[model samples]
Target: MQEPTLLILTALADEPRHGYGLIQEIEAISAGRYRMRTGTLYGALDRLLSQQLIAVEREEVVDGRARRFYTLTGQGRAALAAEAERLRSVAAEAERRLHVLRPGLQGGAA
Candidate 1:
């Protein structure tokens, strides 16, 4: 839906990740722009799972505490690809506009 939400879906697109792992991945992927709280993370997870975009792939205990891993569904993959494409398109347009306006926005590329 939004950037953080889209980022969450993108992170989960690569592989199954537990809640905490998903948070870490998103933070890393976005270079720390998206820091997800447990409440917000779980809320998004529930919505995605309910929409059949993601599924609980497995549950296990590492040190006596249970954790669940979630994997993206086919629908999730398509959505992620579409979202990525959209973001890329936006970035490309931004770069084109910057080229017209500043003419050195790329920092030594031109």
Candidate 2:
């Protein structure tokens, strides 16, 4: 999966969030490394909805504007879990190789 897609799924992992809320949560999750534009976010939301990875949890009007809250589907949760495991495996192998290359190195010290 793409980094943005992964980040989006992760942001939705804990709880439902509206578009703006997802944006804020994704920024926090990436430690400010990524800031999704509104257009990009909505586009991704549309794609995810079509893929059944996420669904609109609810919709309501606030201050005369309609806001949609999104939640992850079971398929999305499973996909996220699998991707996390794959990342962990890759990281572990990299760490092991690093240790072999530098016996005294610890914790990614350069």
**Index of the highest-TM-score prediction:** 2
lDDT of 2 by residue, 1-110 (tens): 99989999999999999999999999999999999999999999999999999999999988898899999999999999999999999999999986685555655576
**Model 1 C-alpha lDDT per residue in residues 1-110, reported as the tens digit of each score:** 77767877888877899999999998999898778899999999998889998999999997887899999899988888888898899999999976685555646656
C-alpha RMSD for every candidate: 4.1, 3.4
**Candidate 1 off by > 4 Å:** 101-110
C-alpha lDDT (0 to 100) for residue 2 of candidate 2 = 96
Q: Give the lowest summed-lDDT range of ten residues in model 1.
A: 101-110
TM-score for candidate 1, residues paired by index: 0.84
Best by lDDT: 2
How much is the lDDT of residue 6 in candidate 2?
97
How many pairs of residues collide in model 1?
A: 0
Residue 58's C-alpha lDDT in candidate 2?
96
